[model samples]
Target chain A: MHMLLNTDQSLTQRSEHALKDSFLRQAVQFTTERLREKKEESTNALGDWELWRERGRQIRAHTIQYLDYYLDQFATNVEQAGGQVYFAKDGVEAAKIALEIAKEKRAKKVVKSKSMVTEEVEINTVFEKEGIACVETDLGEYIVQLAKQTPSHIIIPAIHQTREQIAQLFSAEQGKAVSTDTKALTAFARQKLREAFAQAEIGMTGCNFAIAESGSVVLFSNEGNIRMVTTLPKTQIVMMGMERMVPTWEDLEVMANLLPRSATGQKLTAYMSILTGPKRSDEKDGPEELHIIIVDNGRSKQLGDPKFQAILHCIRCGACLNVCPVYRQIGGHAYGSVYPGPIGAVLSPLLNPEDEQVQELADASSLCGACYDACPVQIPLHDMLVYLRERRVKTQGGIEKVAFRGYSAIFRHQATFQWMMKTLRHVQKWSVKDGSRWSSFLSRLPIVQGWVRSRRLPYSTQRSFREQWKMLQKELEEGVDNQ
Target chain B: MNREAFLLHLAKQLGRPEIRNPPKREQIGAPDHWKSFVLPRKSERVDRFCQEARTLGAEVHCFETQQQLQEGLQALLTSLKPQSILRWDHTECPAMIDSVLNRWKSRIVDPIADPSQALHADVGITTVDFAIADTGTLVLCSDEQKSRGVSLFPAHHIAIVDADQIRTRMGEVLAEFRGGKPPSAIHFITGPSRSSDIENDLSIGVHGPAVLHILVKV
Candidate 1:
């Protein structure tokens, strides 16, 4: 299995590769546009959207603030329902626990619905190494799995693949020619996955919202694969982030209102399954054994940190990705993390702060604040990105610190700043061509080369802003005298 | 790690030595104004439910009596010509519909029985617990008799709902679970199984029922 985290290449190199792929650029742009427009329309239909967002934020904040208590209550309820709960400190432990469960069941095949937490742990690779066939049942996840790629987007995993590409992947898997038609391709996947669903002994799913009061895991999906994954297999395993919980079903009502509207512009997705536990003794067709693995995986680090605590409020609706300009252009692969876009930029570093490669993802955003606006729960992702950048600079201590120090020294005094501006005017004159236009020499300069690569450096004026202000003042005084 | 240790570590990380009591909540659910949002009449709610259900790509039929409902089911079954039919074992559900279903091989799903029969059944019928008008959603709770598979595994799902069961919004239905013990599973189905995973192009019936028919009795 191919993991999406390719830290061997830096962010710049990965972005350059993504920029070269015109298909990826167009596909990402098209899908994000559609999703963004849908979110706008749906939110518009539900009037007073800001009020709704604030409610969402409040509910999430309240839940996270009391997460410890809620987690305890939730675990107790799950056990009461004849279910087992496992708390994993990290991804490695989570994967190990899942592997142990599989081994105990003697499972040969496991059908999985899409879950970002599983990807964070690289669970598929672990299961495959243990000789367990892990099949991704979600249509988009199945496509990417067949192509040996990781999900590019949160909601729509295979947003980067074109129909022709998917047809090729399916054809290769089936060992037969398949048409590029969406219906035909989906039909083939549906037929193939049905067999896998029946044959698999264990089913794995990601929890969207785990209600503490009822000890139920709520799932939102347009396709029915998640339902199948939970229903067909005898043993059901749920991989949930520790933060993915709500205090009660009432809170779930608010979340159910916001998530689907923000995600696909639907009043609700086609299916919203609230699985409380394994099948009742008298029930006909649900999993008999239910195991929920709650993973921290660096989430605990943000608990008391004021700047990033709000990040745990995220519902993983992918609204931030839809409005992110940087994400739309470069696509998800460039971020080089399990998550991509604004959330990824902030989360990748926070989740694995020690890794220098993941730390660099913080620099991928423009900090335009669109992500904050687009977020359903109003998580200030843009602000979190800036904080990550500051932390990185403080720890790494690079040329940026020296340059900023020198910049502060010059700007702290008026006379020194004026002197530096006067000197810069002379340097600008040397760099300008035809006494008016900016020349390539400015871009060639070592000091400004990095900034000029992706942007145009505006030509410096003959006079500084202070000098211009002085002349404007004199002109205003002369005009008053004439009057 | 075990549950107690994990919670303890989290409490320490959160800067509390022990689990802190839940803070006082000023507000709990949707905004104050939203709580009052509801249709005044049952007929209007049913009308809106049917309209929204059709918009989501599900077939809706309304009847004035049980006989009309049976006739409607008969016409639908005769037209679709499903190879097999699966019905839930519920007292509220019209048992006489079996006469119409007798044309095809039919069975009443026992909650304790093996569910393999649903995998091959072409049509599954169940009476909905509740219906939401705002989103045209059906709420189905799993029990010994009302198997989750009956509504899920078949290619086509036919849900029979009484007009009085229609509610105004999702919250109204969710509110019922606030202080009660929830069932093993509660499914809120809006439409037939659909996916836009393939390049954002919508495809129907990926893994569950492709066609959903909701029969509302007045």
Candidate 2:
């Protein structure tokens, strides 16, 4: 069910490749660091940041809890507002619906702002195969598209590429050498995409929050590309996740406050446009036909499952990415999915449950819980990752299962546990002099090999906890006699 | 798939039957302190707005009187010396503002009638329905007279903002849309269109206006 990324390489193999790229490591570190600092400063300014996070979590929880009620209300309102609504059961259907609209409209070109849902659906690929030119109007998305790659970062899609690589990509497109100057490169894209905007007959966008009451699709962007897309095209297509909803405009204020702050730490993006259906019958601009496609790939599968339902509350803020240790080490490409970082680690497997490749992403994290702390909606992603691993373990087994079987055997009785701990401590005292030096030897061990390859762990202290406790009790009795 | 099937799937996954009605929330929107918080005085808000707007790379000018405003607008337009300008015809906009554009009336042809002309127009000037001082945002609602394109389609954008319309936060302005249908398009323009996407290098005015000058009349 994975659409864009070539999943030929396993998640570990992909991550291994990412780790070898020094440039990717540094770029991920720098980019996440910058965003993290900005988020810290902005959140501190709010003075009770946790309270806002809780509020955001509550809002999402409530909305998802009564999703059936709200989505129906939203669909009805969108119809009343003169916008057609489509409910897509999966990515393929969502992309097909979009292509059908383009074909029906006889559109030659479709200009698009960056929408991850489109990536999830591989809509651009579908359009291209249908002979409809789909242009990514967001600069980052444009760069990635020109390079023929998936976005590495969610918001800053081309975060993995350097200025030189970007320049080369742009130069090839323009049939001339484009400079590495930020200003010049931006000017080139501006001119290049402006032409696309004017020439395209259909526009596509992702809804940030679909207000249930007004049936308006709110889009927030710093680049104003969304405004151009929605306004320039005659027919507009908005592909959104089913959970991307708020009860009303009043609730939108909460999201409006939380999303931008969590994303880039801005009070607001440069433009926050709320479009309620198509342009009015008498109005001069905006889309003449608005289509809202609500896609539920595998989101409904987690509905009643209490452990996973909160995962639906994610706002796609990318805050968790900045704090995720694994994500910082290996950029988004390593995740091998549309949604990346902690959210992606949990989400990808759920979205494509039968794919074992996505299931391997569960082991990608150390379960540090930084993602949980950073999450605006407080989705316990770390817990979900463990849950995913637990689910997968039932269906499969290897060293982990074997090692845990041994672990359970020893722990079932105090005598076995004591014997094992004593034996291990004796071995540790004899051979565990330098952890890093001996780690490679430890890596050769059959059961603990996977655990020790990446980290250096000495076996134990010279004395076990039981031995130390006995010694302490003897000393205490002797000291009392002296007193 | 049809809507009922999709929704029924959700209901089944939720372990319940489909629902059409739910209890209303007692309160929706921002937290109490956030919604209630405001700058101490108009002067502070004005100062804060100018600082925030300038921080976002938008030029801001404040005038104490219509006389000062006219001179300021005239000087600003004169410096721009645009070949053509697109101004939204809004009654909410002061007549003096239109009178000022009348000075350059020949440049104010109805570009909206022609999409190419609208795209090529040198400048777009329109009246903001409301303004948020906290984030230095302008709220523009669309109608027949006030096309959303008037603020979007140009390389340079200027906004006519009434100082009295400035609220402390975005929640305040969003609160007004509680009972009625909002306009087809409501644009909250915070600053010149910008992006930090290319190698963390900021390039302002990418797809929308590169330069935005907000004239706040006191």
Candidate 3:
């Protein structure tokens, strides 16, 4: 049931690999820091950020609460606008639908702007298997595709790659040596992707927000690749998550203000293309045939579950990722999902709670609440992590279960807890040395070996709190005669 | 699954077998206070727009009349020395500039007989639908007379905007769309095309116009 289209490495293994790559760790930290600072500055400049965040949350909640109504409205409007809408239950079906469209177009090549839903469905593999050349038009996506890797960051997909690596990737693609200069690298990609854009019969883009009122698909990009994807090809396909809908153009104004500032610290990206439908009969450019595939792909599972439904309210701004401390340290590869960071930690599991590997991703957070604070829509991801851990423990009983049960049994009885504490005090004398060091190195061997391996176990005080309280009370009773 | 089955399944999962009618939206757009926020004076907005647009790497020029706008365009064309120019077929654009632009191989992009001509042109100019002073954005709507490629495909884009058309915020521009069906395409161009994909280095003009100039007529 897991729809993650990345590698199968466990969270621990991926984190270990990421930790060893010093460059990746530094790059992730630096970029996340930059994004976080920009978000802070822009939000502060805008003023009333908390009020706007609340409005965004309210809008998302309302839309998702009655998603059926909005979605039906959106589909009908799209149809009236002369576009077709398809609903897919899972990744396989979504990819098959896209492939079917491509085949019907007799497409030999397809150019795509960056779309996380496409990655989730593994759509490129489907197209490639069908012998259609699928080209990633976004610069970051183009680099990652050349290296045959999934995106490591949401906004900046190639955040894990250094400039030197990108130069090599571009050189390999161009069959010539390319310099590490940013301008040179960008020019090369522009030239390379220009051909793809010109020759491709079908173009694909990910919808940032689908305006339910007008049936318009809004795309935000700094590079304008989306503009090319929507304008240059004859047939256009938009793949979107089922929850990526806003009610009206008025609501879109709120999202337009929030998403860019939270994502890249700009009032807006360089280009925000709002395509209502395919080309009108008199228009010279734009796609002639437009198809929008709304993919559920496990999104429906969150609808009724009260605890996890808020996960669908996310706007994919990556603000939570930038502020996540663990994500800063381990980078996106550690999550091992198309989405990475705090959102990924909660979303990957909720999307497929039955998969052991996906369930284990919940353990990748520190529960520091930074992500919750950073979230523009205010999804309490830290609480969701705890809930996931509780569910996991309930389903797979372990040593933690026995330990908690024993502790609860002792604590439920006052006398038993007191007796246990007294007994432990005597037993600690054998382990604790005279001056707080261990009496012998071997004395530290038994109970706390795992805990003390990386940290010092503090010596417990000889007198417990109850004993000290009793002695103080006796002293107070005798103090009247002495005075 | 078919669309009907899909909607039915979602409704069931949501625990509401029947689709709920749209709720009464109390707070549809921005907050009431934001809606009532006062816009700056026309001259002040124009000044602020120039500053903000420059901050985002776009050049801005202010003029008081069509004659000044024509003179400015002529000077810009002389300095840049572009090989060819493309202008949108909008009446807001001054007709006299066509003479200045005629020195080079120039064409109006109204009935775009060939799309590649605009794509290969050295410079493309269009009169914008509206300008946002706060974000320094220009809104362009595509129609029979306005080709989307005129603003997108060229190396340099010069947008002629009237001072009165500038609004204070993005919400103000979007509020206009509440009345009718949107056009085929509406693009909000903030600045020159840019990408920080290569190690977070900001490079301009990756896929679209490299330089964007806002020529404002007061």
Candidate 4:
């Protein structure tokens, strides 16, 4: 989603931009808080939740470890079931393959279900460039699509857009002012998308899990738009990450249990469709032609990485985003990627190791471990964050390296630490006093200005902690002598 | 791109040679203890399923006798007031339900027919193959006779299930599908289609049935 016009701006610059949008902050907070509370209740209700997380982790890890085999098995089975498979090493190729299919089928319109992989590949942009109308069928996705922006959250794509904003989008589409009532807005999307679904020549979806046993493509959704996308069209294309594999149907049960509870607090999403292949010879509905594009991109890079391989186990449930403190404060666009939040912090960097801007997303988390706990498969994102930070600094030397190095050298020696503190205290005098506190000027200083924008610099406290403690001890001695 | 190069790179990345056969799994499905959390009796399972369905915002009606079923079906059909009804030709459908359908103008969902028939129908009636109590899910396997459109597309859906067909957990039903020539589509529907996508406001019937009426025959 490199939607920043590919500018040379830093993460803080984009985050500062997001921070200026009070509506965006409130919208992000509102949704994350609601999702976090629901996740807490749902996971607790599931009982022995950690056991489920472990099982989920085991299945994902085992499948990822033997991914080449499962993928081979899955491909053979898909072919046996009368479906075709294509392999792409990266996003551009994947989008190219999908477009070729569209061109071959002479498809003029494609209705799409919500798929982060599709967003990552920018397939809609690919089709739009060719004058093919690709309509996003999911309600949140449709809203974001109308606004011409990428999804901000995985589950709730328009998590940063309020109802009024959505209403405005719909109104512009309708050529009339649409009310902000949820019912009216939903009705409009249903009516408009239904017509598109009925006429669409091709349907595109993202695979939630590809079963190696039966070669089934499983999709979970609450709005049922996925069903519409898969059913109403003549040909279907599925964008799949190479790692989205499970060995059998039984393992799907595990994912089915964990994903819904983690994402939206549903015991099961309203619709969990397992489509094995194109419709059987006698079947009425479902796509007649099915093509699955397995994209590797940089996923292969994580296959053997001991420190980063676990990231492949992520289900894209967005639970990590809900509990991430940094994601809550700044929202998804600040990460400037298709994925956002703690998982995004690690994944965006791992997915695009060469992009220095993407690498900075690794620092987006607070290292709170909340994301790890909230994760359905228990990816140790906090630990991975440290690992990414280490790799980043080692590979790409930056001003931050010098800053932290100086910080470490000074803090380890008392004399230098005291000297630095005294220097800060003296320099702090240049800072003008605000209503009740000093260091308002310090916040304007170059190195720490970003840090002090919303926070106080604490005035360096005039005396160090050790100095204050020594004076307190002498005062206690004097009091004892008096007694 | 060549598939061989793609998978080979993956194998190399995984630090192993290519694997030809499926590896034996150490763990499968849900944990052992979850299977033990089963209801003791059929009635208990039925009650649990009904309770779950109601909690999930579906209307559950239990019928102990043919008369009750007839009355319930009549009331549901009349209340919905559907001018056209689409149904699946489930071989296992009860004789009574067939006779009941005969009273109304209904036809089996014919694949060869125009799809717009199902698209325009206000109500769809289908017999669920399995009813899971643990999550109140209806498992519908689509085939030549059992169409997916019967359950989807309609604004209202009426699913009939035998109470004893209800299982304790989703895994139990899933375990049955281990090696069978499974249907092309197996839908696990927990509730009527819904979305909270618009500013997190829950809206039912966003592209699927708004009202899910479950008829459990005890």
Model 1's DockQ? 0.78
lDDT of 2 by residue, B1-218 (tens): 99999888888888888886774676567788887798868877788878888888899999999888888888999999998898888786788888788789888758566778888788999878888888888999998889988888788899977788888888889888776878989999999989998888888888889999999887
Best by the DockQ measure: 2
The CA lDDT at A373 in model 4 is 87
For model 1, the superposed segments whose C-alpha errors exceed 4 Å read A1-4, A432-447, B105-117
How far is A371's C-alpha from truth in model 1 (Å)? 0.7
The fraction of reference interface contacts (C-alpha pairs within 8 A across chains A and B) present in each candidate is: 0.87, 0.83, 0.81, 0.82
lDDT of 2 by residue, A152-229 (tens): 889789999999999999999999999999999998998888899999999999999998887889999999899999
Arranged by lDDT with the best first, the candidates are 1, 2, 3, 4
Q: Candidate 2: where are CA atoms >4 Å away?
A: A3-5, A427-443, B24-27, B39-44
Q: How do the predictions measure up, each by TM-score?
A: 0.96, 0.97, 0.95, 0.92
- Candidate 3's DockQ is 0.79
RMSD of each: 2.1, 1.8, 2.6, 3.1
Error of model 4, residue A5, in angstroms: 6.0
Error of 3 at A315 (Å): 0.3
Candidate with best lDDT? 1
RMSD, candidate 1, Å = 2.1
Give the per-residue lDDT of model 4 (tens digit) for B45-155: 999899999998999999998789878998888787787788887677677777777777554444447676667678888899898998889999988778888888888
Error of 3 at B53 (Å): 0.9
- Model 1 per-residue lDDT tens digits across residues A1-483: 123578578898999999999999999999999999998998998899999999999999988888889998898889888899999999999999999999999999999999999999999999999999999999999998988888889899999899999999999989999999998998999889989988999999999999998789999988899999988899999999999999988788899999998888888999999998899998778899999999999998999889998889989998999999999999988998898999999988898877877888888888899999998899999888888988888889788889889999999999999998788777766666333345466567776767776666565657877788999999999999998
